[model samples]
Target: MQLIGRDAETGVLEEFLGRVRAGESHAFALVGESGAGKTALLQHIAERASGCLVVRVEGVQPEADLAFAGLYQLLTQLPVRFDQLPAAHREALRTAAGMRPGSLNWLAISLAVRHILFAASDKQPLICLVDDEQWLDHASVHVLAFTARRLGTRPVGLVFASREPSSEIAGLPFLKLNGLTDSAARALLDSTLAAPVDPAVRDRIIADAHGNPLAILDIPDEPLGGFALPLVTKDEWHLDTLPDETRRLMQVAAADFVGDPVLVWRAADKLGIAARAANPAIEAGLLELDTLVRFRHPAMRRAAYWSATLPQRQEIHQALGDVTDQRTDPDRRAWHHAHATPGPQEAIAAELERCTVRAQSRGGLSAAAAFLERAAILTPEPAQRARRLFAAAAAKHDAGARNQALELVAAALAGPLSAGERAKAEQLRDQLRTATSLMDEVRRAVEAGGNTDEVCIESVLEAWRGVEPTTADDYAKAVLYNGIGRHDAARDAALRALHTPLVITELAEAAARTGHFDLVKALPDPVGDWASGIQARIDALLTEGAQADAHHRDSITYLDRTHVRIELARAHLLYGEWLRREHRRIDARAQLRTALEIFTSMGAEAFSTRAQRELRATGETARKRTQPNHNTLTAQETQVAQLARDGLSNPEIGTRLFISPRTVQYHLRKVFAKLDITSRTQLDRVMLG
Candidate 1:
């Protein structure tokens, strides 16, 4: 049938292809329910993609257990010159494909895939289509997703069609395939039918199908009321009604996954089943018998395989296992044999455990986890099962399935683990918890401006103790040292973290405090309001009189527009000191008093004492404020206050902090109350300046 009801989606693809032809790379994902035209749309794009090197692979469900299976299929289609790649990348790809013996580095493989695609795209624009991405092997999908996201400026376009959306590829543009429009569904249904239907029956069918094209065309011949199945349920009811021999044949075909006719026929012959048994299923529009024994839909194969009794399924697996060529495909044979064995079998479990090692060697953490989990189920000994489960949990954790890893670890811990095993499992659990906790703490600290506190820094440092230091940790240390009046250490740390936007303000402050004016002058122009404020402060100290006055004014204005209260107060104090040197005692007193009031209220005694000293120089002894309010800015309130002062909308602030806009509004209410301000406009005068 001609593809229908996707003009907008097709237009997007056309434009995307146009861009690819113009030497800009792009990636897109097609997300939809089963049979909601993802495959059809992908094929449509491929057909229209003239002059492009199109490479496509359909993720086979049965092959998902095989490490790098989907990637192997894709690479085999490419005209890759392995010799052209960097030596490490070449070795990584060769090892992954079993062409060379070496440890598999998934990162190296991902990078190599990118190099290969970019090289190909230099000659001709490339279109890569992955159909049924949900069924792709975990390792292959990860590498492909990684490559797709990093394909900047290359003449390539990657399109993935999947029933379920994956977060790993969530960065790619997604076209969600909902049902066809009413008129379009009618046109499609009319095209499929040989005879005209009554209008009432037609409307009923349309409503039942919910505009799903597959359901509209494949509605059973029986009366609609008793035979209708939703798109989600698919054709399970129809599969159930087939003759017993046909159902058995369908099951056998389903079990011969990848739809290889030779495997299906061989297994059937062993079971003494005639090929004619497939006729009933083919007549029912559920099976397509040709060179490959295939199902009409992926759902149909699932229905066929699941419709069989456990014992019948086991028999089918055994028959398939007996016919499988072990020398050529030991993994498939072992998998089938494992399925055929009803209870725990040590030999089969050992074979599956060996498969885990092979999968792990290929950098297939998820596939290894699957094998280990299955082996655990098949291991007769409780201690061995516990150990296997723990190993699977570690693999799962490495694969980024955090919750599943936690559950598996908990299961392992509850079993009869030895002291060492139990300690290791508990450590894994602590690591998982700490991972999440540290992320939350860092986000909270950044948003709340609480990273300056000694207690907060110590807590984070303790949590991060044994981990290798990242650039982010360097940034954190910069902020920590700056807060503790360690300018030299802060400047060193800030220089190490100069690449990040958030470190710009800290770097400027630390460099200026340590008499490194030349360092600030050599830095790039600041972007954000806070960074500009700090930059202006540095400029003020390097200039004189009117220029100095203008820089200080600009510094205060810019600081007032950001969430950095401490920086803003520092700006006010610095400007006051400059005004004092200029003999503008009246202006200096105003600026110094404002700084002293804010610093004292926030319990920043050091800055407050400096402000008091500056005030004394201006012939005014500033009164000490009532002891600082213990109920000053809270964690969330401080974040909201800073963002609001910085001129961000509630929605934007909420998005930054991963909270709802209403929650942002609620936090803002508390912030305004804590800062003793009624409107955001007053934030600059009271908190920022």
Candidate 2:
């Protein structure tokens, strides 16, 4: 098939291929909607590229949760020698491909895949084409994305086609395919149709197709002058013309999403469908039988699946569930079983909950949220559903999806719940609100003439009622009181929360206004390299001697973790205040400005005000300025950029961050775009300035 209206995209692919042939590496993502010719473009590249070993794999929806399914498909097709890789890598690959009995180690598997691809590319230029990448199993996506990013000096070119945006490959170069241009659309139409139609009908078909090549070809030749139909509707109409058994088989295939012919055939066989039933679908150009069975276009697959009756769809899902291998593909089997059960099923819900936990352990927060959300839907009892919904909300919130978390919390609240469950749901809601409205909440509390000590005590008592007090709870109380200037209460709470001597630094700082210099002197010697301990040592030195400058530098250097961001900001604020007290006005201005930026960005109104006061003491005006867009880079991106500015290569950055080199490059690209700068030299100026 000729690719129409993708000359520019094809050119980019060709250039990448050219680079690979010259022993340079490249990776690109082709992003577009259904019927946007992504598949066609990939096939075009595969056919046109010369002197390269092309390995193609596709994401199958039905097998999305079957870990490493896509990677197995790609690796099995290549001439891979397992003996060439490290034993860990070999074992991981063997486990992933179901050839060995062991847990799947994604890192080991990623390394194995990279080593295999590197060896292959050394023999011949290699091209990897991944189609429908959004449907790829999470494990496979991670490994491939890792390998693609670290191709480095290898003669490899990686290309992916996805219908949805994916954060896994967020920073990769992408070619977005839109609709075909007018001339290209018409040319495609003329080539696709053997017989000429009325000019008016042709014009109408062109307009209705809206430049989608597949939509244009699917239009009926006998269309009347006044007739109109939606693009996918036309494709669904064509599906309606197929025989019952053939159509049902196609519907089953569509629902399979993985488009695996074996699974589809097995499911169809259960429905009494013979192999011949698939012939008609193939003849209709709506189905293809190759390494995998797939619809000609994503739109046709959607149309086929949606065209089935609800009960029939359930039966198909049940059939798939029955055939899926439980050992190797438990998550998908569980999902299919859940979908097949007409109503709530406790067993399926429990299985999905387990899946959610596994996903969370892998840092797949979105996947964990999805699993919990689906588990909630499958829960039979109202209270169980409410609990599941609350769990899902928590997972979503942890994943940085606050809006979705709020929506889930609202849904949980509407469900039948016990008082405890309801309270938990309300608490989650309040937490999310606090994160987004910290400044507003502080202002409201202040305006209402709230006593900081009373409010802090009440909050802690109410939330932790009937439970043993924990170090974390007391710490929260201490922070809350300290924020509102209740030094005595804050000191008391901090002392209670001090589980280890390392935490004495934070407590000492909180108790500074309470004349607790004796408490500071009573602390034991530091034990470990904990940040809290480090900060405390710095604080003790600053308090007792002329080492405030050195301590300030040391405290700031240890402020790296996300959990300690507030402490980092406070360190800057206190250091700025101390600098001002010492008449180091210029240095105080720098520290106070940093503290103000951090506090304002975090919506810490009280801390921001403190920093602003210090700034003014340094003879600087603290203006209420809107946040800069350049500061919107995610924490990971900022880290990557900072490491890059420190002259670390992609692999070095990846090692330090515990991510893949490709991932570092991906985040670096985002950082570059966010800061509107193109190079590492520019990054130092933008970040350090």
Candidate 3:
């Protein structure tokens, strides 16, 4: 196959191979969306790796739970001599590969793989390519990640291709492939077509493809005039032509999100289909068979599943549910049961609810939200469904999927609810809305023509009327009074809301703003790391130069929670104001601009406006606020730049951030490029300007 539109990616792979040949080790992850040429790029690298000993493994969903599945595949391909390794290393590898009777040890397996790869590199530089790393077994992923990190100066290269995000690689260097450029897509289309295409039709195809090379080639040769091309549906193009049995197998494969072939085949066997029935689809490029069955792309999986009738899909789910082990994979079993039961199955809903709890216990908020959403769909009672929807919304909110959380809240509101449930829903809606649109909410509250103090007091009284008032309710009252210029009342309400450390910090700020300096000093120490953070801000405001700077640094190091990110933003704003007063205009401008960027991005309208005012006071015109650019420096980059400007060297910055000096240099290089400056001296001007 002729590869097109991956010059930059191919160049990076070539460089990695060159370094490996020169006795240096390297690891890179190729991350992109499905059908974005990740697999193609990996294949191109393998073909071009002339003298290197290449070993390849592709992760299968069904085998993800099978210990050492990916690692076993890679190790088997290497010409390794078992007798050459140390006895412990040899036994560990043998045990992990199931050639010996012993439990698998993670450290021994990792060391064994590392030693084998290093030994192979002495004969020829070794290159290990792992495709679809998201589906790799947890054990294999951990071992390979360990080996990749410890390669040191060995002549080996580890490269991975994944459609998922960078989380799988654990901070390994990665090259992300976006859609091809317009010219590249056009050139690919030109070469792909057998006959000359009409200029008008060509233009339409180019536009419809949207720079995806695969989509452009998948366009049919029929009349193109007035014909609509689905942008992302090309992966399903040839599926309808497959045999019924093959198509059925594809649907079953699609039904399992993990693509576990064991479960798929088990379900297929229950349906009286032979294993050979899936070969047609596999040959047609619609599916692939490894340790598990997989669709060629995620879109194909969706197409296969959606193409089946609801009854047919329910039958497939029933088969899968029956075969799935209840104890070993209760989440998957519950999920299958939820889908298999037609409507309003209380048993299935309860099972999914239990799964949601388990997911929450593991800190999988997104997974918990998904389970609750499914439970809501399967719930028979109206009130129970409403509660599930509300719970799912809350989980989504905690997971930072704010827009989806609001949508779920709206869905919950449309259903039946008791008065308390209704109040909770309304409160949640108000809280989420206030976080993103405080200015709008405040304007609406004021325009209602009620006395600000009376309304604030009424809200507080109504909230307290409940069996127990929540901190949220008290915080709302504080914000309402603060927005209306009732500083004393705001301070009082803020103090009442001091339940969590975050709320204590909020109260401290409100007290300081109301000229209650004594109250700020007298505030009880908040629990957790935030105690240091809140104290740091208080100390910065109350103390002198060097001590104040130390406080600010401590505050920055302790700020991590999303809900309290605004406090971090406030710290930067206060630090900038202090620097400006001290005539450190350059440093002040950088800090002020960072605060403005964070405030605007978070939709804190009042604070962002305040930051803009501060920037102007520092003698730099605040440009008209625009949507944040995706390419702009990240929060970590901004922090690193600020610390560097404060006269910290790479090692000092690394110590403060808890990263290696090399990592610090790497981040600085990226910071310098993003700010379009050559040296640290230019950072303040370029970053602030």
Candidate 4:
């Protein structure tokens, strides 16, 4: 079948395939909402895969929790020589596929999959198509994503169709499918119609379907009048009109989830449902029963499932569970039984608890968290429930979902937590909050007139540490140096950078510092509020009192809101210097004192001494320096130092702290400076005591 209105998408895919056939490996994800034809697109790609050996894996909803189930499906299709892989890789693959009695290792499994693909592709180019990837087992998704990223010139093309974008597959190319164009929608609707549709009715259907291919096919069958009917109402109409037996059959099929026709029929038999009951659904275009039970669209299946009463649905699940073979697929059986049982059941909860261990072994933290969460819900005891929730939260945190982890931890804390559990939960909460606050601080610094890059240099370094220096980083360094009044350094860096907003600010500041007022004035107006403040500082150099007063006050007000304390103090110092030059001694002293307090607290020696000199000029005696705090390291710096002291390498420390290795190194330098130590070996002696 020709995919309507996807000529552009098809062209891109054709070009991508041509490159793959020429021995370049590529991976692409098809992202869209349900009914957006992601599955149809995958099917179309398979049809066009003429010379390529196509390997298809469709994620079964019922098998989502079964560790490495999706991987097993895809691997079983490929003709790979296991002996060709290294012993460790072969063992890992064997263990993951349940052919060996051993624990699964995620990294090993990923490497094994990559080797298998490369081996399989030696003779023929391979195209692996994954549909409903969101429903795939988490362990398999991790393995596939890892393999896809490292395929470099392997002549393997991996394509995924998923309802939403996944962070796991981030950095890979994606083709997001939207609704069809208006003309395409009209054409598709015309082809589906038995007779001529009313012009107004046709237009309404087209408008309501929003160019969704599935919606266009389904909407033409709905009754329409001069008055418009909502698309949801039509769906409700279909569900409400189905025969009792047919709806029950749908509920059984939906509840079955694996799309196994034999399993569905067996479960239906257990419920005393006749085979002919599925005929009405088939006739209505809601279901297809042949080799397997298939829904017309995912939406139809969902509607069919939700149409049944809660007890009826549970009964269907129970029947499906009863019919499922425990020895072959215990995880799916346990999940079905858990759903069927309404209240807390110790046996079922224990089964789910055990699943978490297996999931974690396969490096499926997300899957582990889900199992723990479900186990918690099924636990009869409050204490066990709280413990399970806490474990789940920790798993979520390790999976790099801090916000969700925070929510789970908070929920766990609200229950009966032991003293140790309470402390651990609070610590996790603090970590999550600190991470969020750091992001907010950087955002505020950027919006205001602060050194945003200084707050994010570690993140920048982490993202680009091993990569060659781009003009972007040069511009960033120019901005950072300019903020510190290193005009020569700023100028040198600006010379190597492109003409971005940041580079412009750096050039203008460098010129102004060198007394080139004309160049500063000739520079284009700065972009954001923070850049405007930089421009204002240059303007202050040219103007006096009231003309620059408003700009100075604006800078102070804006910078004060951000957590970049050093930058805020600098803003105060600049404004105070201007006030003093204008002979406003009283106003100058106030700003100078504020700057002094912050600079002193942060151990910014130069800025603090500068603030003191300004205060002395205002006729106030410079206050004696407060005794320096024994420990002046910020929380993040301390964390980095402790990890370094514990013998963690920079990259390892960065991983634990969720920063970049470069950022970890930067913090280590600060730690060494504060502790009067030249090497990491001294951290143990100086920091421990």
Candidate 5:
């Protein structure tokens, strides 16, 4: 573990040397990331020093950030232990070291040496080496700062190599080395490693390493542009002492590419590790700041990340995921899910896999998409990847992201899928039709009310035209195509269902959502008539006094809970506007609050925000709420609206979202009404402006 790569660190060393040569003790802080040749640079400087006594001291972050752990090695060298220290002496050391008075540790001894070192500095040039300065604990930092401040007047020359900055040494002379430059990295790689690696490989390794010499050194020379360096001893690091806090922080950081600050805070809070302790860990260059926190060095990061068992990692991920899920932001949700350590591959993975399959089976393609996302995180095999891709394609199809859906299908097909999987993927591949037939049929099926016939379940064959498929029923096909922005196709699919006896309720809801409002409004019973239970719920909401019964509505079956919730929310929002138009501000406030609250409670923050914006626009105050799915967009509505807002007329929208011109208008009304803004102009403003 002798030092390496100090050729570039010469300027800082010369500055320190010159200051010492002038008979003035100097303090120079060398700041750099861990595994960036900082330690090697220090050793090189020490080797080159003449008549300079080198004293190397290392500091580390602690579980409590208490003083003394940082200067442990120095303290153990003290002549007097517990036996020779007087009470006043002990008290002074604790205070200087930032340690709890009664806490028994090496801090008192270290503080005593700290005093001695400064006194010696008055006599001769003494180079004090303190590594990992950022992790030195508050007390150590204070003591170092004090020493540095006074050293300029003494004979001591202090040099610190730090990868990160801290509040300490605010004005002291410090040299900061930010990993190697590209040219330096290229040369260093070429020198240290061997030949088979091409220029690109060298560049990639250099880029990935971010110029940390130590990290670069770890890549197998075989991979390092075919360069090979002689082997040294095993991974023996001089920084042998693993402070509990540092160890814990490193372990967590290793688990992800980088840890989220919010997530790190929440995790520390959950684990009961204090902020004081965790902050130092980050400042110490131990954590790589990424979407998730990780070790800055690839070697250290991998070591830390894989330290835990699969089960342990799973628990950590699950904890973080749960915490992040509580956040109403989709970005946060995705972030948390990204790092959720997969728990046991047993039921957790099985459950996720099943959820993905079932969502497809039931025509709840969006759910399939979401569940597949979770599954991908938990499972990494090609089979799982293919399945997840398939499910996501189905979901994208439902959402009207047709191109995106096709891409997902292609990805699934590209996988090393089994015969069944390949056949299914190929089948889906064959269905990329431009027809509006199936899209329309699915719309009408949704218009036909009832459990089995819910619009959410419309798997109309007509919608499946351009959509290639295998083994999937028309219902799955219709719903998926509609979901994927094939509104005209979705409408046609719904229409075909009119001739067959099927659940019209789901169909109407889907059609209504798809912007095929005419079809939705023309449906029978609970779906078509607001006087029916479906419409009655809204009428009752209008009559029942908004906000009085928050979350209270005629409970719709969870079968189409996602759709029903969207509808009820819209009605309530409309009712609030109606109340406001009538000068019932108080009533409007309550209704709007209720609507937003309901959406929020459902984890539909996007929708909740929409409702809140309306409330704000109308000058009605709304209570804070969190929901996941309240924002309204039928698969059809989403399609038509997307094209409509793009300046496409009803006919064009019909072609895009896959419905007729009439269907385009049908979805436009819902979009405008749901948005609580009058005119396509407003919709246009929302989209473009």
Candidate 6:
């Protein structure tokens, strides 16, 4: 499907491509909350940028010793003089690249990442794609600035995509994204949601998501309505429902500046220090204690810290690594050994059903697996942990993390687990083994960089070409013709995409993109017709009590809407339409403005230019509607009116001020009418003269 929204981002990318194609240096910093589609957008842009060799290094939050993993991935491929690298980062990147996932030589690894790109040959302008610069090591941070400055005049655009604002990559061309607009969000709901939703309820769901596209589409059900959902800052969650003991443990863990065993112990000690015994909040699932006393989510710790008593709170983060120094337990001592930040959630069961439900709702199957890893680590019983581990592996397989999923499943089945857990793992392991093979093929296909569309077409044609002409293929042809400026061809293709006997999701998407406005649905129902058909269906579904499923289904409409907006931008550019906000949706304009501001702040000239172009074209326009003011009143007229307003009769005013009674009467009448006050007493509320 075509991408929607991201006008500002696409404009910046087009500008970068234009510069690179012309052999100029440019960079773009793509910023958005996680799941705002940064990686997907980057991939699309890279695919389209002419003559640009795109090398992507996805950022993963590694434990301390593995900090430079991203940089290592790049350095391993380039045949560069390790000895010739700048003294500042040469050894650091090399050493870190050689370390394991959970190790901690951050100083060296971080340094290596900074200089890894320096290994790039002056051979060509390379477009390096980096995801999550916010977690980059110090060396990587230093080298990023150096490379950006040193490579000027070379056809290179370092596309840095991040979730949070990073001071390191500040002053580069930035494109910050907010959630999709109501229309975009609705479009997403239309495609993914299985059940129907009422229009009013769907809108309310969007509002709850706070305009964050990922959040709107992911909210599973009302039962966990208030859980930590996306686009919500950590500061917003309410704490009244949580056990006080859970809150206490969380506050303590948050104190160490890091959450490890030593810090947990320190935080726990305080509960007793203040004369309150440490209670069992463990039963409520508020806190976990295996190697360390920790909360399920980082937000949990943050909230506790923020709400803690100031005097005690100040001592918690003991200056980065103070408390765990003297730990004896191998498990608890492990906590103080690393200095990385905590993650969103830490479920101690490998098969995290709650998280999976949330993930599926949000379309984040991969994340569900990652979260379940915590459950694996935190579970007390070996058998329970094994079961969770296997569940996590299976979930990972579903999420396309085939390798990780395969490894986890194998380990669970082969481990010294209980009969039940082991039996489940053995069965799941076989299933995963089969999936892993398909994943291997897909990865190979993705890596070949062959014509993606042709590959897709070949597969579809091989199966269904003879039976009936694929509507999607028909649509593709229309798109190709449209690209050559054939409006009629584009229209026909769009019609085919809409009219073809296809999946409900595909039809809704085609309609939304092609302007068959009636095909779009009002609710999150997947089966909405060409008009308000789906909204009606959603209502029917809701009358029967499938609220959660309805919400789950409705979110896809918004995701699809997001894709369409991106496609929309592509169309506008193709047709030579102005990249301005005037012709765009209000929500699009807002996201674009934010993205533009970020790019501009990043010192990305090309991207900033594009942002400005969009802002100029689409931002609200204020016409020069000036009101010419021309009013005249004599001082005598004012004095007369003032007296008349002071409760004096016209003759009395004339006698007091030595004026003619006729003039006084005239002024009083004018003042009364002009001031819109009939009674003399009302003159106080109005100013006359």
TM-scores, each model vs. reference: 0.36, 0.36, 0.37, 0.42, 0.31, 0.33
lDDT of 2 by residue, 411-484 (tens): 99999878988887877776666455443433333222222443343343322121222334565556556555
Candidate 4 lDDT tens digits, 1-689? 77889998888889878888999999989998888898888888888889889999988899999988998899889887777789999888888878899777889889888888888888888999999998998888899999988999888999988986468875679998888999999988877764333454466456546688887786523222211112232244376687788889988886665567888899999999999998888898778877667676645665677777779978987898788888865655666777788999888888878766554443245546666767778988888888888987898787656677888899889889899998888777766664554444335544353345433443322211122223346755665555455667767776676444435555666666666656554336555545555566556656666887877766655544434545556667778888888898987876777666555544444456667888899999866775233347755567888989999999899667544465466568767877888999988898853
Candidate 5 segments exceeding 4 Å error = 1-8, 62-64, 75-91, 94-115, 222-689
Select the stronger candidate by lDDT from 2 and 5: 2
Top candidate when judged by TM-score against the true structure:
4
Best by lDDT: 1
RMSD of each: 24.3, 26.6, 25.5, 25.3, 27.4, 31.4
Tell me model 5's lDDT, rounded to 2 decimals: 0.53
lDDT of 3: 0.71
Q: Encode model 1's per-residue lDDT on 1-689: one tens digit a residue.
A: 35778888789888988998898888889999886888888889889889999999889999988989998898888888988899999889889989998788989999999988888777789999999998998889899999998999889999999988567877778999988899998888777653334343455456545577887777543222111111234445577677788888888887765456788888998988988888887777777766556566545665777777789888998998889887865656666777888999889888878766554443245556667777777888889889988988898788666677888898899899999999889878756654444444444434443235322343333222222233346776766665555779878987886655456556766787788866664326566675677778878867788998899888877876765555666777888887888898988876776666555544445456667788898998555444433246644467778888999999898667644455467567756766677999888887753
Instruction: For model 6, give the 10-residue run with minimal summed lDDT.
Output: 622-631
- Model 3 vs. true fold: TM: 0.37
The Cα local distance difference test for each model comes to 0.73, 0.70, 0.71, 0.71, 0.53, 0.49
Q: Which ten residues in a row have the lowest lDDT in candidate 2?
A: 222-231
Each prediction's total of clashing residue pairs, residues at least 3 apart in sequence or on different chains, is 0, 3, 1, 0, 117, 64
State in Å the error of residue 131, model 2.
26
Question: 424-477 in candidate 3: lDDT tens per residue?
Answer: 887777567644443333333332222244334334322211112233466665
Model 3 ranges with Cα > 4 A deviation = 1-235, 360-363, 414-421, 436-689
Report how far residue 256 has shifted in candidate 4, in Å.
3.5
TM-score of 2: 0.36
Clash list (residue pairs), candidate 4: none
